[model samples]
Target chain A: MTLTVRLPGPAATVSGRGQRWAEARAGSLLALPAAVYFLVFWVVPFAGAVWLSFTDYELAGVPAWTGLDNYRRLLGDPGFWNSARVTALYTVASVVPSIVLALAIAVPLSRPGRVNGVLRALVMIPAAMPLVATSMVWSAIFADEGLANTLIGLVGIGPRPWLTDERLALWALVIMTTWKHLGLFVIILTAGLQGLPSGVFEAAAIDGAGPVRIFARITLPLLRRTLLFVLVIAVIGAMQSFVPAFLLTKGGPAGATEVLPLYLWATGFGFERMGYASAIAMVLLVAMLALSLVQFGVLRGGDDG
Target chain B: MTLLTRRRLLAAAALTTASGLLAACGGSEPEAAVPADGVPRGKLSVWLHQTKAYDAVFTKLLHSYVQEFGGVDVTPLYVPVDKLDAKLLTAFAGDAPPDLFKIGGWTIAGHARKGRLAPIIPKAMGVPDEKALVAQYDQNAISSLSYQGRLYGVPIDYTICCLYYRRDRFAEAGLDPDKPPATWEEVAEYSKRLTSADGRKVGLQWILGNPQWTLMQLLALVKGKGGGILSADAGTATLASDAGVEALRYYGSVGNAKLSNPLSGFGLFATGQAAMVVSGLFAMDLFPALNKQLVFGESFDIAPLPHWDGGQPVAPAYTWGWAVAEQSKLPYTAWHFIDYLQREDVAARQLKDASLLTPVKGWEKLPGADPKAMEIMAAAAPHADFGPRTPVWQEMAKALTDAGDAVAFGKKPPERAAADFDQAMRIAL
Candidate 1:
């Protein structure tokens, strides 16, 4: 008698519950492919790399556990220190100029104009160009008899060895990296600038704020999140700077431009020190993580202020 | 309700199917192919760094071999010489590697030490009888293919360093085009005479920034003066010895005398701006293509490297060869291809086509061969000395270059640089 009473509306309730369950099951099943891909490609390789860092793994032979030996060797190695210093110098030198140049260009170009679209498209050309092609073109430009020197010479400056001189090699790399990445930074920052609410700027203008004042107080403050995003990206890009250092310098001019990635490549590929390379990669990962955290903290603090 | 759910499910499935099909259509063609014969079924890939003459010859050779041996299909992968070592190592570490490859002699020991090389003597391909091969190559050239007292590779070509001069430039500069320099002193004297600064043209050009070539030439000078870069056993660094220091000073003096233009050397040599340049026989094929007439001469009078004051001259020889991977499945097939390539007729044709000197027994003396090729072979055959043959030869070579660059760039005195180089060798060795 109780069941018969409940059955009066239970059919609809049961159907509703069954539909929700089916939808959730379908959603999870749809997600399964991506989950499998991520597990196989990313997670497995990353775990393997970390595990290999603790072993004496030569590429040609079986890996044997030799815990901390690679780390110990890395600590005492002068080359490692040299690489760390160069990497830091490279990051600061490349990222700072890139961001500054992007901001200077993008902020102005974000405004409407007859040539704004053309100019923005032009800025993105370098970003679309292949890294190897850019490096090759820059190599020609930085050659001893290249265009950079030709221009410098016209200004009554002596032809300097841009790629060959130890003192100037890193600067050459900085210029190359800045040029290569300026387009990307501009695109990101321009998007951020474009997304800012125009009403805030209009209000500022109505209050007798000049263009510079409006930008400083209203526009910039509002674009903080976007700038933070660009900063994070630039930092990551700078830390992984390889192509410029590799192609232009070959970590040369007496190892003046050697960085961690190049050193890792040389050790693993050139010298066949797989475990050591893995260890270096692990250190690089940790360093990158620490840098990201620091950048995050600074961004948060700026937002609060 | 069930019908509606089924419709939604079918639509989602259709979307995924369309996306996957689009992806498949956009992706590159799958490399794996089913072989006609069940034997030699997998892909047979060869990695090479020769993008010019050797590359052309290799492509042709691969075609011939695939026609000759029907089971295996071959793919030739090209890498730049500077990037080859790194790429090979990365590929070897992964699940797939080229079935066979050619590498520089300096790289053999390092790869062999890691057991990456297929031992030709016992495990894989049996070593060829040295006596049955060409007579132009010396024992040392054969020794370059050996690791730990066993042969691991087959010699392909020998590239000897010599003085390449522009016959027209030398004649124009009032130097005898027929007779090049016979000694370091002679080279300096000729360079000074040939050097001219008309507007912007400089006479002799040498690459100052490159340490390897500069150091290798310097080592030749040292050996010519009766000294070696290391002990015979490779137990010590002898770069700071009197002969070594003297060699460095001499090489530095070429830059110091302003006989050679450091700024314009690489470009000038390519453009025929320099009257005489010290380069390898490998450039013989290139000169003809550069719209220039080139004449070949030995390091000293088409003889051995110039003799020191009272010592016999020593010339440095460069050899490159082919090695089989230890992990290879078809060792006999690999051996067959290598042996076939070394046959007199095949070797001669390759040498003629590629403008390379074959290391096989008597391909140099083949009738109707290019005269310049013959002259180079004759000049380089005697007094040829292979560079240091250690597992760490590349590192040692780098160390030597660092020292040489210091001298070439005038960053440090030759003596001081040699000392530093010796110290570096000590650490690296």
Candidate 2:
């Protein structure tokens, strides 16, 4: 029921304030279940991980409280250091190409044409596929006698060990990662392009500006915020890549593709060192946050320029 | 919001609450007790790994078990191989482990040490005594199932590796189709002769898909060179000994010989792109049915797996077994079920249907099993032994595989791999 109050005074003093306040209270109560769910499921588990990181928790037995021991060990451990280096390389190799390729494709698909629309739809098919199912195809594609070599062989390039070759495994993973995720970014950038102001473009065209000039001065600067979101999400996604590495290489050909997340999993389950895995995960979380913040700052800093 | 909307929301919330409460009330036990004479009466939950072609056969066997026992309601749980470890761990941690679980034989000792497996009682197995039971299996097989001189699980199947060669490939290379290479030197020579000039068709296909598989096969070669991967007590790794180094060098040179065209041995051998492999009876199932080029006994044949020229022949036994869980309430019932499956005729039928070799003696003489396949396995069985029997055995296995991979990649020579393998085992143990 709609309730109202009557007061004979100034317009500001009249009526419906209590009803508005009641409405807000009702809305908050409706959201309480979702807030409680997040608190119980995500917040509590995250807090538990933080607590376990400082201790020696193997999950099979009682966890012993050992202050900063896991962290100290992680810092000094050669495997941890190697994994960090590999993760960094993997993040860069996957993210930079993904963003560039996404933008490159988005620009073509953003135009008004039937061909562009059809091409956009076709490219988005992989984005809908389950990564686990696609991983099998990728494994086949990266095999020694896979289609990659077959195609390369046609031009006399001969066969190359795409997965087994230690130097190339990370790159092969990067390329596959890009193939799987590039469609999402393409759609994001395409939507961003659609939201771009047409008057500005028309004005630039009227002022005798070329496509390159207009894009350089207007489109890129305008798309900074969207690109920033894409970059941050990409970095966070790249850091946590596990299934592909797990199924494809298993961090092998000499631990060349052992990203931080893969190492974290191996330590936790394979070796049953949960505390050390949690400690490494905490570090990864911090790295992801820091990189995301830096991306925000740099992308925003470009607004003034 | 309207009164009607509020009323509808309240009804929805109440419905959800009612459903939640209903779900929280777990299922009750069956009202009727199992009517059996000697058999224990209860619901028995047995967890087995997934086998697409044989799960139904096992389920049928379970039904027969139910009919024989009268009232025991047996629940068969099939876990996928990849997820079995996680599920078992979760089940144990949750204090709701199954009555019996089929696990890799190599891990029987490891799990037994963790108090996960219940010791098998001879009475439960219908044997006169534990002595008689122990006497039934070979020394190595029996010893592998025992922990601190106490038997804990029953070995069901044994996978003994042997040399599988293509008769057509041999004929193409102008070599003897009847006699496969019997020594490392002969294998090396045969590999070169059998390899295609363009390097497309490989001579020998090794288990390069996973390092663990490679390490398992290499154990046989390592044994022939007189280097034990682990000590008798599984206390120390002796992989860096003179014999161990020679074995590593020998295997490394074969891998490095460039005779291995494709690393995927299963696919290469199935497609007839590779001539030979050291494999189990798994190929007997895949090749005859799936291989477009293969015809059983005519195009392909098996012999005892080759080893070093001057060394004794060896083959690694990849075995799995069934054990009653310590947490089981129906331990006797579980044992009865396992015992039923292991009876002479039933055991032969079960294994034969799956193209698997039995762990029991005289299975070769039983009906249903492929005679030729049994003959080949029996020839190798005398020389077969499991990898190792330590709590840290798997860790050592990993180290061996890593060292083998390093050898394959030329990152480490055989001597260095052996040295590093010894160091790794020390760290792992």
Candidate 3:
């Protein structure tokens, strides 16, 4: 029961097809630059790094196929494990405090006011400055008689070798990193809070719920997605952090601050062991990916719940 | 071409470009350029670690060379001392290293082994052969810049470590201002007396957290105790020996670890917080420069580096060398410029202007040299240990630093620290 309705002429069809083809070509031409960039900068290096991880490629020599030898070596490499442990500890220590403090600060700052606006700008000043500049400023602050010790001394604590003691060095870096990154997260969370539906909090308040209860039952659950985003990003940034440790400590005070990135850099550039460094890099990449996935799953699952 | 075909072509071209870029990092040895004449004639790139005094002398010398040669154009890049090694390594990896550069003596073995350094061109240096060139400088200093029995560089800014003490601190501690600790035991006794109850003032402070200085400091102690960092053949770690443990124990016994100065005890010594510091000849000039009130003779003076009570005296030395890159297109020109830079008259000028000893023969007799400091250096020159010549010096240095810090910070027993160093080096070696 095929019945043909009045259709466009062949000439019309051809003109339409030609116009569509031209549009497709233009779209492709627009995308060509970005596509080439992705292929050249990102994909190629990633593929090369993965391949190099399986070889014995010192910077000065030809790469020789070593199969699983480099990866196998990582299992027994104490430096690698120490760096991994340091990275994990540093991530947790810095990220948790940073996110919590940011949220706490953001909650107060979320309300639109001129004073809050001024305070927000004041908070973001550290983030607006370059990381290297902040790291340098923090180096002076963490010195033996610097502000950190001076503040502690006010409470009767003696001056500690903040950057020189292994036990204290990582924590010192954490303190600095937290201070440097805190403002950005606060701004993020403040934006997230502003974007949230106001009606839920208003309804909760009208139902005789107190501010604390409203926040616990309403604000938090609503802000879970934003919190997850902040958490994922903070964790990734901490994991990839190199500047503070490198500039201040150079992975010293007995390797307390030798995070994975610094160790990878030392291995690759300092020791010229490109292959092993690449393997470490791949592991780091995998770890970051897995962590991001878990964060997504946990947050999405909470949404389902 | 068809649209789809053109897209594929673009993708292929992108892939090829990426592959070529990656492959370019595989370093290649540049062909050596033959000398046409004694006068240098080409563009030359020179890299140096920035030092105020040394830069002044070097810049003048560079300008003089360019003016004298007339045919050559010279471009100089001064990197910070800390960043020079990494920058040089990166340059090497990219096959775009400077034609000539100033590098540390420790890097000689590693860089030479990797075929990154051009061997000595005696003809360009106006010497008959490597033998003549070796005769021109102190043998120990010159030999320290060699690898695989081939000379790769000329020594500049050579310094043997010595003990620098504050006269004021010595007098304050009820010790004779004219006398200084001559042995490790005396140093420990002096340090105890000099250190204040508050622990801010300390004596004999080790430079904490610096690998090169840490290695040098520990090397002297370990060697003085009749132990060596590496086996004679440089194939194994021998730092766990009884001698090493004893030396480390002695190291741990002295020096207050709480004193913090980024300049490595030198700052402390300059500021009157530390009574003594182990330092190279450069500190003689550096002390006064660090503080205006600190005069060289009245406030601070140097003594020979202290040895273990019953051990042979050892003065650990390190040298910075001017080397030509193996990949340099103007190898001959680079060598010629280095030769001009290392002349005896220029060496004297370097001493007068920069306090940089060129380690040339008869350097002690140079007019501008301090008689007392020169005497100490001359006396110690025979015993100067240039440290272990190994291709894995960076790892070795880090390992030594770890062991040294462990002992200094009271984190581990001397025996355990030395053993851990051995274990670390077993993997590195």
Off by more than 4 A, model 2: A1-28, A55-58, A66-85, A111-119, A137-150, A153-169, A196-210, A249-256, A302-305, B1-37, B79-83, B93-96, B228-246, B255-263, B361-382, B411-427
Please provide, for model 2 over B143-178, each residue's C-alpha lDDT reduced to its tens digit, 9 standing for 90 to 100.
Answer: 678788778887776678888889998998899998
Worst 10 residues of 2 chain A by lDDT: A296-305
lDDT of 3 at B118: 92
| Chain A TM-scores in order | 0.92, 0.92, 0.93
Model 3, A1-305: lDDT tens per residue? 99989987858667877878988999999999999999999999999999999998768889998998888878876678879999999999999999989999999999999999999999999888899999999999988769998999999998998987788999999999999999999999999899888777778778899988987887888788888989999999999999999998898777889999999999899888899899999999999999999988887533302
- Candidates 1 and 3 compared: the better one by DockQ is 3
What value does DockQ give for candidate 3?
Answer: 0.43
TM-score of chain B of each: 0.81, 0.86, 0.93
By TM-score, the better pick of 1 and 2 is 2
Q: What does candidate 2's lDDT look like per residue over A250-303, in tens digits?
A: 887667788899888867775566887899999999999999889888897433
Q: lDDT values of the candidates?
A: 0.71, 0.78, 0.89
Q: Residue by residue across B121-216, what tens digits does model 3's lDDT show?
A: 999988889999999999999999999899999999999999999999999889997889999889998999998988888888988778888888
User: Which wins on lDDT, candidate 1 or candidate 2?
Assistant: 2
Local accuracy of candidate 1 as per-residue lDDT tens digits, A1-305: 35554445647556877978988899989999999999999999999989889998767678999899889878766567778998999899888989989989998898888698899999899889999899999989987678998999998997777876777889988888888889888988888888887777778888999988987887777777777888888888888878878877788766678888988887777666778889999999999899888877776533312
Residue pairs clashing in model 2 are B34-B71
Model 1 interface CAPRI class: incorrect
Point to the candidate with the largest TM-score.
Answer: 3
